[model samples]
Target: MSFKNLPLLGTAEIIGALNLSPKQTASAANLAHRVAQSAWRRQPPHKRGLSYEEFASTVSDCAWLTMFEFGALLALGRHHEALLLADASRMVHHSARTDPPK
Candidate 1:
């Protein structure tokens, strides 16, 4: 598929297109979360994971949810809450990386 077609799609749809199983989907999500978290924890911080840009470009439904939640918190001026969400997202990422599904 092409980048232009991503926004119109969802994760399940993508997985379906790729013929991936539920376990595979979960595993991939976990793997991606870990990678994103590691980048976020870097000294200078990294622009990785399912960021708004990446979601928009790649049409990742999960990333879209995260970006929406983060943006909503920021819009409400809940900086602390947003940070917590970010930290949580990072933790999930780490979990996925360290304890991948079988």
Candidate 2:
């Protein structure tokens, strides 16, 4: 799925929460996107065994989890953790495609 379809909150709410400048909100979305990708990977180690429907449902749940993490980190001003989550998200997102989500 496109990252744009990761099920984010309304833009106004997100920007309000972060208290960012309009310019900063753009970068904030990128940071929150890291959280979204992390949430996408929050599946069981036995994911290779799941059916397609199971995978889709799991993706939906993980997407929400990523949103949760993004909100917390943003509220706390945890930019560094956002970076780490972004890096981890990239790695996990890549590895899932590679090794089938172990």
Candidate 3:
């Protein structure tokens, strides 16, 4: 899937939360696209054992959840962590591929 298709890719709300300028937002979108593309190619170590369909689904789901986590962190004034979560691949690689938080 294209990173453009990633959940909440370039919403105004996210832009505001991050206090991104127009140029910064564009740069961020490009960075997200690059990160997603790289993750698709490498399948992160934990995800390597999965079949193609599973891997795709896992990444998609994680992307969505990470957006929510990003928002929450921002709301909690956790700007630093939110910025890190902005890099979708970091969570995709470290978080679960299938399991949701309990």
Candidate 4:
């Protein structure tokens, strides 16, 4: 199936978990979308699109979960820690994408 026109894949679920304001939900959804696109681009061209299993796995990946945790931090008024966590998560994902496979 085509993922080209899809909205953020897990927006509803993210919103449910975040239970935050619109701006916060939008921020969380944007991060989730980025993670999903990154994961999608790693797939082979022939199979490069959203699949149920991949969607499940991508949303559950540590990177995305870290973003979810970020939302929780915002809810708890821990902005500094949330920013650190997001930066760390992005670094890890970038490293994974750039590192040579063993």
Choose the strongest candidate by lDDT.
4
Residues 1-102, model 3: lDDT tens digits: 133444664455666666766565555555555554566678667757866445545655456445544655555567888788676556656676666889
- For model 2, state the Cα shift of residue 89 in Å: 1.7
Better of 1 and 2 by TM-score: 1
TM-score of each: 0.43, 0.39, 0.45, 0.46
Kindly list the per-residue Cα lDDT of model 1 for residues 1-102, writing each as its tens digit.
Answer: 122322235544555554655555454454445444444455243444555445345534566445444544554456798689889987987898899579
Candidate 4 on 1-102: residue-level lDDT in tens? Answer: 222323344545555665667666655545555656666768787776777456646454455556555765666577998899888887887998999999
Ranking of all predicted structures according to lDDT, beginning with the best and ending with the worst:
4, 3, 2, 1
**RMSD per prediction, one decimal?**
12.4, 9.4, 7.2, 7.5
**What lDDT score is found at residue 101 in candidate 4?**
100
lDDT of 2 by residue, 1-102 (tens): 123534455555545665656456555555555554454466567655665445545555454445545644655678688668657866876877789534
Best by TM-score: 4
Superposed model 3: Cα runs more than 4 Å off: 1-3, 8-10, 44-58, 61-102
Task: Compare candidates 2 and 3 on lDDT and give the better one.
Answer: 3
Itemize residue pairs with steric clashes in candidate 3. none
Score candidate 1 by lDDT.
Answer: 0.52
- Alpha carbon lDDT at 84, candidate 4: 96
In Å, residue 61's CA in model 4 sits off its true spot by: 3.6
- Shift in Å, residue 36, candidate 1: 11
